[model samples]
Target: MPEAVIRTAPSPTALLASLDPLLRQWLPRRRWFAGKGRPITGLTPVAVTELPSPAPDSDGAPGALTGLYHLLVRVHQPPAPGSPERPGDCYQLVIGVREVPPTRPAPGLIGHVTRGPLAGHVVYDALDDPRPAGVLLEAVRCGARVGPLRFDRDPGHEIRTGLVPRRMTAEQSNSSVVYGDRLVLKVLRRIGPGTHPDLELPLALARAGCARVPAPVGWMTAELSGDSWLLGVLQPYVQGAVDGWELALRELSKGEDFAAEARALGRATAEVHTALARALPTVTLGHRAMARIADGMSGRLAEAVRTVPALLPYAPGLRSAFTALGDLAGQGRTWTAQRVHGDLHLGQCLRSPDGEWSLIDFEGEPDRPPEERRMPQPAVRDVAGMLRSFDYAARSADTPVPGWAETCRAAYCSGYARVAGHDPRTDPVLLRAFETDKAVYEVVYESRHRPDWLPVPLAAVRRLAAPGPARLMP
Candidate 1:
């Protein structure tokens, strides 16, 4: 148990002023930081709360030297020319303060604070420290409230305290800590108003009796300006489960066929989509809505070509795919739209030791705005993302494996059709357009981040953009 101490919330003005210089240098370097390539002009404090720390030392001395704080700060960056001015992006931060730096170097050491109430204290990311991480879980277990911050847990769930914390390193857009292999806590780095799908979707699926997703056991939030901002969520950890991406690559390297696993994954995805539809609102898109969606795809392609000259050659073929969808809509075609995984790929799935597949990370594309990510879309959109993932896995191999990706793609669609009551392949144009759009997104992302890896997605682009009767199905 932590020490019971009464600490007042730090003054917003002094807190932001003291941390401004350190954050300007530290925030962009984080893997979860979304404002890369942009200079931060300033930071404004949204809320601040003092956090609990470890109990007194063994010698009956006070542990006043250690401090923890939860804060929400809005990062200001210059928008593009002629763009309307709006509030900058807000981020959730857990900061730790100590009178002295650690004996051994640790990750997330921000630096020594030179001003404000915390002057001369060494501050680091609290998530990187075990004491602070354990405090967060304890708060959830007790539903502790600190000023504007709220930590609540589902009363039906039992969360054991004093569990060891180990931060997950593979996450790119969020920070996660696993507690004694029992629960995993995902801390949202970027925050916005309204209900976040990461929490909302999983809870909805749980209520609908969906077993394919881990239900939330606890969560943290902040009430600000009449809106609740999700700070983090806690879910049961699947012990000894391997992510689908790593499993796929291992199978590909051994020349083993992955049709069975792919089929199971497809089934799992369909189950999630069905549960979401049953538990949430569903809408049928008319001709105009379809045209607007198609236009967005076309617009993204145009932007990609402008950013990556390598995409220029395939621009015409890709444009045709989007144009086909628009033409179909122009003829009054319509389709059902329901809540989905938003972004579905091999990396977003986990396979248990017993071979059960489970979907994770419903946050969708982290780069997209929250509202856009939460929008209902055709379920085939997720199917296209997974198909592209199969191709990616095959291409990542040491040598090209002929028909490997095709077999997995076909088997996946077959499995989905069995549960969905309709074949995704039945609408070749919609699937093709979605797949093309996903490939184009990959091209842009890889070109900017990993030049050598650009060829993998570009190969898909060549095949997807091939001039033909529109390669409908795998």
Candidate 2:
């Protein structure tokens, strides 16, 4: 089959008027489109590509295109002062177009067409549009078969696919359409030239038998085409699960003792760390990496201290703690580096209905550079993250309860020590140092994004200053 000439042009209403109804159905329903909830003032098609056509249409239609087609759309919005500039805010829609017939309905395609830009364009969700879903699914499934797409961590096993494209719940950052029960296809709205951490790290962890993470089934790479698109990620669907943040809040609200559960979570995290150490090549956390981590905390602390004047009083002590930690780098008290889950907050963990915890979403902190995110760091970084979460849970409660924080901390540390074989007491100074650094990071995080939550980290900083006697574990 001759390759259709890949082309680029601005698409006006007139151009869309002549296209298939299916095309119109898809353009509006996508999450990557800027005009998701608003009217599209105008649209300019930045680029387009022709994919191999799927098998012939069942209806015997002549000259019907059945291959994957990519569209880059710039959506115009009402001008407003001080609004942050985002590609999605202007480029309202990105559609991965493909042609399919009515007879073959792709799996995972039926759902409500909620309020959004697409609702006015099409009465139903795009997956409900029979033609487009079938075309995209055929392309995804076929792409999986084309070659041995090795898992990043375990290259020995090739990726297998049985993705059925379905409409996804609305998300803020990217467009997600599930591929059957096996994988999720997340098409990024913004254009960037780096590998998405969401796709890369989870696949690496899963390949390493990090059972807590979703296994990568396949992924669609749109790099070579120069469009700066993340076609989609195919991952195993974790069934009957609740997000860990919600679960933690629920447990805390119910007056249930979470010590045992916290300990279990610690163990699960240790398992993840063990897998990471085994699967990926390790690096020593030398001066450069330590300085980078310290510098990040120091920078955020400075900004936070300035913004929330309340933090200023504690600034001197915080600076001393950070400097002491940084000084350890020169003493050769280095940590082994391994791939870590960049973002380890409660929201990133999923608890199955059976009460088992599974970590989801290996996309590290969103603000960090891709290369920095991929770089190995001390496993304790994740431990420090979870510890901070425990403190947050304690502080945000309606009434301050005695022993709640201590109990949870002990449980978590116990589980971690059991698996990682590190005694928390012996390393109390180091552990507390890392914890203080994490709290400082949160101080800035909450100040900038959620000013209301500033008290959470501020209280933590106070607690860190009053050093407590280390409790020796049996």
Candidate 3:
């Protein structure tokens, strides 16, 4: 963590301006900070909405704040050494002001104010304070509008406010506060414009009567300066549930079969896809789209080979996969495309005590542009991502299980075929190409971030890019 940049200001606007340089100095240092290791050109304030300070608690306790502010700040970064420049991303910030310094350091403290209305006061992240966090829930429950922000509650579900909140730690991109075990509210740290798939897909599935997802009970949004931003969302948190990644590792530790669980998860995935197809727009992928996708994959592969010299040996084999995709497009074949969990992996799923698999985190790939995430794509992309995860888990374990990942892979495809009316295995050409492309991506990612884990994906690269055709199962 970086040291907080303290500043003194006479008023709110001045406080923001004084704190701007400090925020820019601190942002790239935090783990949840997305633009880490990059130089932040500037921080642009898009909107700032003030919230009513809460009154005393029922037990007559003082509220955390006499003032609350919700901010939308756009973070700008310059282009990579050789890449083109891109647009900045918006982030949500909630700050609280108090007359006295906190007994303990606040979660997101940026230091104290030294002058004016907030003189002799301390300022910290409002969501880190229980009282102001409650205000967010209150607004959601009553469907109220505070300044430019609007909160909405699903009429079918009731709200439970005033629960103590504890911010979850060690997160990568967002901050989530678990409100007493009743609801887990995820405050999106990197605020993007328009509706996120995390909100849109679940609501659509819930309305289409799909039980494979935990629907939001309440949601919060913002319409400021002619742009809309998704702020926070509330969902019923299933207690005693373990995420699929942890569960898979646990079973692997015991040398137990995970094929059955994998099958069920595959069915759940197909069900969600079916529901999404029914609820949202579906398009027939055109030749131009296929060409573009093929070209993109080829470009990524070229870039990966340049970065990881180990990929040089497999370049020929990798080129064939993209070439095959182009061949498919040239044949005038027609394919259907629809919304998919753009970043599906074992960590993105939850397994309940009752043995049901619920897919969570519909927010697509955070690295990609939001506009691209909303576009329709082949559902096989998700299947490919999951396959890579299954392999990664087995390889990452202390005791690597032979034949285990392959068995689960086949069983999962079998289950998917049962519901989707078409086996992903049947489309060998597309499936192989997608799997190869995904493995190449993993190799690049692991090489850059976790050098020790590079061998895990490199193993797949060697196999998929071998002389024989890419094969997932018997």
Candidate 4:
């Protein structure tokens, strides 16, 4: 056990209670925090453990002070009227306590601690401190089991130590730190007692000999009361790689064709889907199952319309898409359901300079429950998400590129058909419903987070709801 884990001076419960006020104010503001717009009524500590310090200095001397702690706090928020009662969400936090502020200003500073175990300390998100980030990677490299936290690495890979850490800034639902171009560690902000798809899917794909996704190099987990919760994952960092979203926007700016790149991405997606089907148990969703899924989509649309009145005009058309899905089920249609990248988009993909594409971030819609995200679903759901992403990129340009999205969409489907032996366009009903569902989600997300971006998805909503036969391209 590390020295930090052995200390017992600060009671975890007491520490959490004292920091309640600061946490309530800080948690909601975080991009990763899910309970935005809802006022936090309270925070109950579920589990807390001290973390190890950074490695020794260059001369092998002692390291900095041990002020980092791993915390899982359940946040309680007042529910909306008629909403089902449920336990509050649990968020994983890495906090650092310093006697004084860092030499340079840092993010996530929650002001000085006026009370608590260390009354005179300054508290901030520990990940912003390189020392704590290095400690996490070191623990993973050594496969350390400290207190309730377990750090493990794949036996096939050896992680090098002393890599400098720089936090990634573009992430919205999780905090990722890149370690000197070798590895990137993604610390999941919201945690629950289940195997997160972010770690599980990658490992499974690696086992199935799939190279379209990065293999996990190391991971972290927490054990509390005989249950395991996934905390973080470390994977190889694709150096000199640009994400698909950025690539799309750049190409659009120069009036360049992105069909070839989109086609390759589709092939990559198909490969991942094939591997997932082989690695995990798959099922055939029959009439009842498909109907239930359609009902859920309709229910979500109803809720979204209520939340964003702007969706009202397209409600009837959107409902027709879902209705077509249910009608298919009524006609005894069945589709294969397997574990998929629950939420897929261009942003979740990385394109190397060599033009090879690799998929990342399988955590799914952060707002959805963990178990729901882990459930089996039609692979077309991912295909639909990518399609919406194409439209979004095209519309996001200063001057919307006409036919750019359509050309890319056709090329992508053709590429997928080459690998999977079937094009997603062949299932127009399922594709339209899933794409509509994705647009509805985007509408709600933009309405709440970025009103300026609302028109992008709204454009898709109008096209998707246009009265006509379901087609491959809008």
Over all chains combined, what TM-score does candidate 4 have?
A: 0.94
In model 1, the worst 10-residue window by lDDT is 56-65
Cα RMSD, each candidate: 2.7, 7.9, 5.0, 2.5
Give the deviation of candidate 4 from the true structure as CA RMSD.
2.5
Candidate 4: list runs displaced more than 4 Å: 1-9, 55-66, 80-82, 469-473
Across 314-422, the per-residue lDDT of candidate 4 in tens digits comes to 8998899999999999999899999999889999999998989999999999867788899999999999999999988998888778899999899899999899999
Model 2 TM-score, 2 decimals = 0.68
Query: Which residue pairs clash in candidate 2?
Result: 33-92, 33-93, 34-92, 36-117, 53-67, 75-91, 164-179, 164-180, 183-235, 342-364
Higher-scoring candidate on lDDT, 3 or 4 = 4
Order the candidates by TM-score, highest first — what do you get? 4, 1, 3, 2
What order do you get sorting by lDDT, best first? 4, 1, 3, 2
**Candidate that scores best on lDDT:** 4
**Candidate 3, 101-212: lDDT as tens digits:** 3444365776666654455666777777776787777778778776678788899997765676777663656777778878888888887778788898889999999999
Candidate 3 error regions (>4 Å): 1-13, 55-66, 98-106, 112-122, 303-316, 443-455, 469-474
- What is the TM-score of each predicted model, taking all chains together? 0.93, 0.68, 0.88, 0.94
Q: Cα deviation in Å at residue 235, candidate 3?
A: 1.5
Predictions in order: lDDT: 0.86, 0.59, 0.79, 0.86
